[model samples]
Target chain A: MSSSTKHSKWRYVLLGVTAWLAAFMIPQAAHAEYGDVVINNYADAAGIRPAVFPHWFHRIRFRCKVCHADLGFQFKAGGNKIDMAKIIDGKFCGACHNGEVAWSVENCAMCHSGVPGTPTHFHGSTVQSLIAPAYKPLEGK
Target chain B: MKNKIILTSALALVISGPAFSADGVSAEEVTASAATPEPVVVAQVAGANVFNRNLKKVKVKNAPPPEDGIHDPENEGTYVLQPPLEAYQGLPTSPYGNYVDWVKAIDEKKLQPRWDRIDSSEEAFVMDLDVLREVKASVPDVIFPHRQHTEWLACSNCHPAIFIPQKGANQINMSGILLGQKCGVCHGKVSFPITTKSCKKCHSQPKPEDWTPPLSEATLKNPWR
Candidate 1:
């Protein structure tokens, strides 16, 4: 192969790699999608991956009030103060996750499954994304 | 000397690297546990079901018209059928229940949900009665409207099983609702969800400071008289 042809091929490879990297970065800047909460409160210090809560998955099976009202999950992200010890103790997340209603804590990978070094808060969280479209008063109408 | 030992161990963590095991724990966690007792290194699974990464499992939502399981690949007409995503583009949207806002659609007269499926001779029984539920909380009291519910449901839907026809017979509370009872039977599942944003939708009537329970129909009517 001619030296110029080899150089042009290498240039194209470099351009392709740079474009791929840029494509990945744009989504990262948006910083997480709606209905996902990355809980890193204690995971990094303990060397475990951050727990990524999928609100979408749970919402599909169960109702909003099930967790929020009955199980006592606060509306704000990072507000519940979830810990592995508490989960094992059969509180908060353990209510359903005690090897019966859902998967138990021993199945650690499912909940504590996130890329290392991820921050505690997820941007574009559910509450912020789905704020009341303004209260429509229907009573006494 | 201790600093040197700690530094060397920290470096060892990097050198040993993360373990990819069938079980989701890292080999690093098992070995490093003696030194750092609570350390738990998770096996890194790329494209894990995090951040709705379940979508990564299936590249496209629906296969192209030719390969879609429902469509007959041999037929040309199957290829020309409207794509599902494109067919739903312009309608009003809600965050839940498949993202379509049927309530607003009805208000705008875009789509009518029901074309009187009941026998045309028998007019739909539409009740306009409102039952006030006086709550002890400082928040506004709840007003259950029969008009809205009866429009979609027959009286038999909730009568003997879910709720007895007589007042104060069936007990109700927030916890019961959360546990998929009474109002929650439909509200959180199919209808609008019981979210913080939607609290006022049900809890609308302002409670009176000197509120008293209303009398029963039997006590007031005295049918014989």
Candidate 2:
């Protein structure tokens, strides 16, 4: 009766990260929503806000391969090693961000609008959610 | 970013929703797309960011055709078209893209997605193989169903490109997907955003119970055959 194990705070962090907010967030609306990713790798050193990739905005218009395959964008957030140089040179995001395809990379605030201290991750989705048999505190054990 | 270019010259392209024809779409893919793929730049103002606002949030979803972001709200002609909310009525729903369960609808014959654009008579080269990626210690193994994807996509869409078409040829993991490499390419983007609710959707294979491998006869201290 005395065998009680204390759960770590990190576990709660994972739980909070994956906690489904849509159930409570939806206020009488059947809307479309996709995950957003935040990339902060370079911004920390570059003295700029983290970039917020609205994947849904792009994905809605093209196939996954167009960016991931043809454009050579890595699937993971921040995995593309994006920078202004590459964008100006027309590499990763510059492929479409150019004024011709969509918008030019000169629009810094467009992507770099993310919060200052965000980590590189899928905005709403977290690793703990994708893993099966997701952690659940045993009920009334 | 929500500026209106309803009466502009580009309205024709914007109204049809071309340039971003949404791959894996159903049979209704009108070859309205241009030769070179481009963003849906139908109504962007000069010097303006393509997406001026955050992508995660939408003010109104599935509104009437006249008021929907893509439609020409000022034009009375646009109002003649049925609203998405009405069209989506009595259909299967999901918590993702358009909130329609297109897969279930397709399976139930309510939707018949063609396999090709040029060949109307062509049947999908549907494959039924399921590859299991084992993840021991925690989480169930992932079950890759070829049939579901092949029905919507083609061999060229993935084979030897995103993934090699051979056993043990490709390396896959959640990290890569989270990084937007493997399955992350489509999922968590257009198809279905990754969520805790969908973990079992892909990670479907049940893990084997705790057990040891079969012991060799030599290990039993008997003359092993």
Candidate 3:
């Protein structure tokens, strides 16, 4: 093959590779895509139904920083040791569930709403990127 | 002929060096390419299709498209149609581009939901400052009090949409926050305004003397409600 012809062909191949890499790195977001976290840490053992955390509902109104960064929530399900005491102490769930900020955490079944036979609350398509364990809580806390 | 082969090999190495050195490409592919000649490297470049095929393992479960009625007619019968607008499309070109203006519009239009709290999540959160400090931030690291905001707002107020819910996902800085990106989303207008002069409000430490450690016998027994 001629030198310039060979070079141009390689250039086309390079361009194609670059285009493929870009698409692979950044996948399109699914419309109304969301994921759920089933927190079984202490809920089931405590005689309460395991709490199911929804991603889509919360994401629309508030930014993730409020809970994950400012509020200090771990990204993984059952990652944070959330308990009733902590909630009542005005920590974790308590921070908001207190009567002033949100509905008082008086009801046990609010988050533990997912008892057996109750259909889990589901919404939005599942986002592949978000389904991964993204929240890495600060270390040495 | 030997020099031509060497030149081709050199070019091949030059192209593939980055993918190998960065350790992002597969190790198996790297090892295979390393033992082969220039033409083999070219074939390996072609094999990037295989790499992409592996990445395609991320399955996007098809959900019904919104009934917005903007889908292309050609794909009406198919589920592969694109949304009306891409996510990264810029905000409306109106003067109300900033947070304050947008909030005003929301209030005027009664766009704000009466129930700010979502039906779920009884727990609030408190992210520690230690993580920020560890990054060698010049200023005292800011503390996020989740309950303070969660009372009024819902989770979608900020999340994977605005600030990714993951640590190290968003590049937050005072300058950007001041310009109304991160904390600036509300702090200035809706929430408390930030002052560059005063650092203690958000940066205050858990008073060493008054701090009751978690897992304390009393806390473990029944923390003060």
- Chain B TM, every candidate: 0.50, 0.58, 0.33
Q: Can you write out model 2's per-residue Cα lDDT over B149-193, one digit (the tens) per residue?
A: 866666667777789888888888777886557787777654665
Ranking by TM-score: 2, 1, 3
Candidate order by DockQ, highest to lowest?
2, 3, 1
DockQ for all candidate structures vs. native: 0.02, 0.06, 0.04
lDDT score of residue B123 within candidate 1: 41
lDDT of 2 by residue, A33-138 (tens): 2345667879868887666565434533343445665567665667888888888887887876788767677676666654455566553343434553212211
Q: How close is candidate 3 to the true structure, as a TM-score?
A: 0.28
Interface RMSD to the true structure, each candidate = 15.6, 10.5, 14.3
lDDT of 2: 0.58
Which candidate number maximizes lDDT? 2
**Candidate 3 structure quality by residue, lDDT tens digits, B101-201:** 22333335422333324443344342322333222344444666655455445566576666787787878776666554677655432244454433565
Query: Which one is best on DockQ?
Result: 2
Indicate the residue-level lDDT of B2 in model 1: 48
Q: Which ranking of candidates, highest lDDT first?
A: 2, 1, 3
Q: What ranges in model 3 sit over 4 Å off?
A: A1-33, A117-141, B1-225
Tell me how many residue pairs clash in candidate 1.
Answer: 0
**Pairs of residues clashing in candidate 1:** none
Q: Write the per-residue lDDT of candidate 1 for residues A1-141, one digit (tens) a residue.
A: 999999999999999999878755542122222334667788878987666675434543444445655566654456798898888887778977998777677767666655556566533332223453111211111
Residue-level lDDT of model 1, residues B1-225, one tens digit each, is 445655676676566555334457565664455355555588777567456634322223423333422222344443444443453456677764334554465446454333232222444356889998877667789998886665445665667767888878878887667545777555554456666767887899987877766666787898775
- Give, for candidate 2 chain B, the lowest lDDT window spanning 10 residues: B27-36
